[model samples]
Structure formats: structure tokens, C-alpha cells
Target: MRRILAIGGGGFTTEKEPSLVDAYIHRLIDKPRPRICFVATPSGDNRAQIDKFYEAYGSLDCEVSNLPFFNGWGPNVIPYTDFKPHLLSQDAIFVGGGHLRSALAVWREWGLDVAMKEAWNRGVLLAGMSAGAMCWFETALGGPFEQGNYGVQRGLGLLPGACAAHYHNAHVSERRVNLLAEMHRGLIPSTLAIDDFAAVLFEDQQLVKTVSWASTSTAYRVRQQNGCVEEAPLTAVPLQESLIV
Candidate 1:
């Protein structure tokens, strides 16, 4: 089945980070020691984020490598990263978060967008947090990057409808409002939202599971009826604290 896991950001990328939810993401891969590739094309291949990805995954048994899209490192400003061969070889692709607009542009230009859909068809798990997670959906909340606020925009469409990450963060109230308002206004279809420390897993375009690191986090299915946008909570299975380490 084609699988996509949308994360709410902050899970297993640093020594001090929590891995409970991340562990769930890793286990989805059906390999003894999965070949996991990190794609930080979204974050402009930021060095620190790339370093953290290696550092965190390095502790695990999986073989890890990163696909960096650096200027001059490729044929043009978009980079010449050969998107398929390396992607087809991996068991999973973990993308990093950054400016979604620019990230999508670069990926489409490099053919990484098409390659990613191909990888998904071949049973490779496509997953990421925030902007990374947002990339796989047809529409997502959090963009335009103006005035330090959020808005909705088109996504890669690997998954249907819309999604918003960090749903419960107090700082993102405007984001939540914008998403619900957009839905209520009939600007987008039904949407999904996940708080930090949680993830909504989709298999074959169907939501198969919702899991959270701690009992406190959750996911939601939001839809518009008439002129109102409402939320129906999706209970997340709580992970044992032991799995966090």
C-alpha cells in the first residue's frame, strides 16, 4: 500500500529530541535495516538541519544518506540532483521542513516531485514534518510567509484534501483560524490537523492510524457544513514512554 505519514514537527532529529513518534514512523518501513534517505531540499539544504538528520538517524541501525540541493552543486539554480536512481534505492524518504513555496518549486524543477510519487508507488514510505508533511497533500495550511502569518497553498497531491501541522501550538492560532475559515468558505476540501508529538498515517489514501508520543496529543478531521467548519477528534494511540528513548 502507498503510505504517507504527516508529522506535527519535533521528533527525533537531535540528541535532546523525543523519538516516540519518530519510532512509529521508522517501524512502518518493512526492512530489517531500512535504507533511509534524507531530503532537505525544502530547507534550502540547510547545513544544521542536514547535520541533525544524520546525527539522529546515525544512532539507529538504518543506512542513512542525504540528498542536498546546493547552488552550483547542480546544473542550475534549481540544482542538478538526479532525483530517481538514489530515491528508487531507498526504503524511505524523510524530508526536512522549510519555506514550502520555494521548496516545491525546486522539487518540481528537479523532477523530485515526480520521483517521489514514483517512490510512493514502489512501497517506499514518504514522510516528513511541517512543510515536509505539507508537501504530500493536494492542499495545506501554512504559506505565503508574509507578515509572519500562515495561509493555504497547493501541495504535491500525493495525498488528498488538506492538512495543517502544529495544530495545537498556541503560537499558531492564526494558522488554525485561517485553515478553518478557508474550509468554511469552501476554498478547500475537508482537512486534517495534528498537534505536535502526533502523526496521522495514511495507507492507500485511507487514514489507517493516528498515533501520538504522549497521551496529551491528538489529531482531527475538519470539515465544512453550510457555513461552519467543525472538528471531529481522532483519538491517537498513546506510545509507551519506554519507546521514547
Candidate 2:
């Protein structure tokens, strides 16, 4: 099945070893020493983030690599000529967080969006946190609007509905409010809001479950019913329990 694991937050970026969310991601890949590639385009291919990715996955059982767009092609960077083939060869692809509008524009300009779609169709696992999580849905909240206004941002449409990442995270209180208001005003369709340390799993474009390393973190289904916006929490299975045997 084509699978996408959209994480609202928490992973190597915030946690250390014994990270339940990262472990769950690794388990989803069925290969022995799975080929996992990290795409940090959203972060403008930030070197620090790239370093963090390597540091985190370097000791793991899988073979690790990354796709860098900002840095010119080199011995380490995958050349544009092999981009599609290289992506398709991987068992899983992880995208990093950054400016959604800028990231999406770059993806389209480089045709990486198409390549990603092809990769998903070929059964490669597509996953990421925050901006990465928001990239797969038809619509997402959080945009490059004026004065940090939260607006409806279109995504790759790999999954249905809208999404709000870091939902209820105290740092992004504005996002929480805007998403609900947008739905209440019928400005956007029903949305899936994911809190830090939690994630929503989709297989064949259908939400299979929500999982979290943080036991208290969960996903929410937000929608407008008769002018009232409602937030319904989806019980999150502990990541450890959701892992495949």
C-alpha cells in the first residue's frame, strides 16, 4: 500500500534515542537495512538540519542518504539527472520543515513534486514532520501571508482534506485560532489538526490511525457544523503499541 506518515512534531529534531515516533517510522519500511533518503528542501536544505538528520539516522540499521536542493550537485548531493531514479530506489523519503509556500514553489519549479507523486505511486513511504506533514494534504493551514496570518495553503493532494500541524502548540497559538475560524467561515473544508509528538497515518490515501510517542498528544478532526466549529480528538495509539511485529 502507498503510505504516508505525517508527523505534527517531535522526532530527531527534538528527541533523543528511544524515540518512539522515529522507531515507528523505521518499522514501517519492510526492507532489511532499508534505503532512507532525507529531503530538506523545506528548510532551504539547511546544513544544520542535514547534519542532525545524519547524526540521528547514522547509527540506525538502515542505509541513509539525503537529497539537497540549495547546495549545488556534488559527490554527496544527488545530481538532477538521477533525481527521479534515486528517489524511486529508496524505501522511504523524509521531508524537513520550513516555509511552506517557498518549499512548494521550489518543488514545482524543479519538478520534484511530480517525482514525489511517482515515488508514492511506486509504494515508497513518504513522511515528514510539521511542514513536511502539511505538504501531503489537499489543503493545509499555515501560509506565507502578511504579518504571519494563517491562511489556507494548498498541498500536493496526496491525501484528502486540510491539515494543521503543531495544533494547540503554545508557540503557534495564532495557527490554532485561524484554522478554526477558517472552517467556521466555510473558507476551508474539514481539517485534521495534529499536535506535537503525534501523527496521522494514511494508507492508500485513507487515514488508518493516529499514533504518538507522547501519550497525551493526539490528532483532531475539525469541521464546521451549522456555523459552529468543532474539534474532535482522534485517540492516538501509543507508537510503541502500533509498531508491526
Best by lDDT: 2
* lDDT score for candidate 1 against the true structure: 0.76
Query: Model 2, range 1-245, lDDT digits (tens) per residue?
Result: 89999999888876756467777888888667888888888888887777777767666676778888786432256775569899999999999888777888888988999999999999999999889999999986766433335667789999988888898788767677777766676777888999999999999999999998776899999989877999999988988788858
- Which segments of model 1 are wrong by more than 4 Å? 13-15, 71-80, 145-150, 241-245
| Runs off by more than 4 Å, candidate 2 | 16-18, 72-75, 144-148
Steric collisions counted per model: 1, 0
Best by the TM-score measure? 2
lDDT of 1 by residue, 1-245 (tens): 78988887767643276476556666677558788888887778787777676666666677777777773232112224465887888888898777888888888887888999999999899999888888899987766533334466789998988888888877766667676666666776788888887888899999988888756788888898767788999978776632454
Per-model CA lDDT versus the true structure: 0.76, 0.83
**RMSD of each candidate relative to the true structure:** 3.8, 2.1
TM-score of each: 0.88, 0.93
| Candidate 2 backbone collisions, by pair | none
The candidate 2 region of ten consecutive residues with least summed lDDT is 142-151
